[model samples]
Target chain A: MKDDLTDRILVVLSSVLMLTAVYMIFFYAPTERVMGIVQKIFYFHLPLAFMAFLSYFVAFVSGVLYLVKKDIKWDIIGSASVEIGVVFTTLVLITGSLWARPIWNTWWTWDPRLTSSLILWLIYVAYIILRMSVEQAERRATFCAVMAIVGFIDVPIVFLSARLWRTIHPVVIKSKSIDMEPAMISVLAISMAAFLLFWITLIRIRSRVDFMELRIRNLEKIKRGGME
Target chain B: MKNLTYLAAAYGIVWAGLFSYLWYILSKQNVLVGRIKALEGDD
Candidate 1:
């Protein structure tokens, strides 16, 4: 009951934050002098990327914990986090491409940052496929835990690709300065908070669903054994 | 008003993706709830 109440509160808080963020993005933030209206996408795009990275990091940590403790709950957390990470990353890519078309004159480019992000996406897709292929629950969990740990190596590379190499992708946060105005930064921060809350809410719901599935599986196994 | 279409598309895709995923999660939850209830009933 306590957990249910907390979840409800979180859902309400996140929804309110999301609506406020949208309003700030469309109305409160000032328009860019150069990019015009297309620049508005930055409010959503940057925050989605930040949340995606945070989600993957959570999955990576959960994966490590699962390996250390051999707990199915940790595996559930890792799985749920990765699923949410993939969704956010997909949004990041789509919003990015949409932002690019007006500015870069192309739908796709083989730039380092873009390529590394795509690789990150592909790696998680492979992780999901791997989990599906293995029939044994324990074995599947163990394998996925390992894969999550290994695949996390790509995340740093994705983040650093623009810095390490010359790339067309804009580096908003540079060594010396951030390339955004005060109002823009404020809107971005609010949007990030909203998305982060939403991410946590989704992960909680997903992990609960995973727990239910685990319970059902165990119950079915017991029933089969009793019949024998 | 220039580049309005791009802004609209970007926002559209973001909301569409998020809402679709939310719908997917809720639908799956509904199915799982039914199955769990059925299992409990059997027990």
Candidate 2:
């Protein structure tokens, strides 16, 4: 269908960008003198974290729109974003742990950034579980909208945790400077763009599936009524 | 140690995680479409 043309193009663009970013990450970006090769994980870890944050932001905006417009489509977008966000958050935690194991010599730590990120993951995960438990469509949508907006409170806390507290996590962006080489910065920018476009493609696929499911449910209900 | 193992694991997990989620979503989509077609055929 014509509706899917954008989705098809975005999928290809994102995949190509992702491959380019990966090649640059390995070959082009200079290795950190102190951390050595393990430092390469930072290229991926930061982008995954960025995408997770973007997902929650989209969810928050969709939640607000759903409340204002009283539309089911907004609910669909919010929940889809949360679902993708949770997967992204899970990866963030795993990748962080991997990086931490080698550098800090510990797999897990209760630092402010780590703790807040875990809490953020749990919040949206609970949001997904909430959707699954409720049967009444309207009530479920309302709960999802409210929860998405409220859960977004943790995102800023997660972002500022390193700065706001005495955390072991590295603060990449300080008051006036970023501490990476020019090449590293370019690779990171490309990686972020790649992931953002990929996230959009994912949203399109998820929202289409949800709309189809909703239509099927409505049709089934009507068919049952007709039979009765 | 230079931590090559950790590096590989980290990148591997990222790719695996993303691909796994994509697979799950696509599978769910396929199943739903099948149901819709079945319903339409019956009517």
Candidate 3:
């Protein structure tokens, strides 16, 4: 009962904040002098990237914990995190492409940041596929835990690719400070907060499903031939 | 208003993808609920 209330609160809060973020993105933030309307993509693009990285980080931690503790719950966390992480990364890639068409004069580019991010997406996708192929529960969980940890190696590379290489991707955050005005900064902060809540809500939903799946599998084992 | 098509497309796809994923999760939940009910009925 308590958990359901918390989930409802999170769902409502996330929806409200997301609507606010949308309003602020389209109305509150000032248009860039050069990029014009297309610069609005930055509002969501940045947050999507942040969430992707955060999701994978959670998956990585879950992997480590699962390996250390051999807990199915930790494996479930890693699996759920990776699934959402892929969704966010897909949005990141597509939105980045959309923004690049007008800004960079191309739909896609082989730049360092773009390439590394694509690699990161592909790795997680393979993780999901590989997990599906393994039949045994413990073996599947162990395989996923290992892949989640190893695949996370691409995350840091994606993060630093823009800074390390000469790329068209704009580095919004420098070591000292941000490059935008106060209005834009506020919008970004709101969007980030909204996305954080969005991530939490989705993660909870996915975790519940994961738990349900485990229950169903146990019930199936009983249905096969075992005593009730 | 420049590049408005691109802007709209970007936001549109993001929302569509998110809502679709949410719908998928809920549908999966429904399927599991049915399966659980059926299994419990058998026992």
lDDT of 3 by residue, A88-184 (tens): 9999999999999999999999999999999999999999999999999889998999999999999999989999999988998988999999999
Q: Write the per-residue lDDT of candidate 1 for residues A7-54, one digit (tens) a residue.
A: 678878988998999899888999899888888898889889888888
Report how far off residue B39 is in candidate 2 (Å).
2.5
DockQ of each: 0.79, 0.80, 0.81
Clash count, one per candidate: 0, 0, 0
- Model 2 has an lDDT value of 0.91
Q: 1 or 2: which has the higher lDDT? A: 2
Q: Model 2 residue A38 lDDT?
A: 92
lDDT of 1 at A55: 80
Predicted structure 2, TM vs. truth: 0.95
Off by over 4 Å in 2: A3-5
Off by over 4 Å in 3: A1-5, A226-228
Comparison by lDDT, 1 against 3, better one: 3
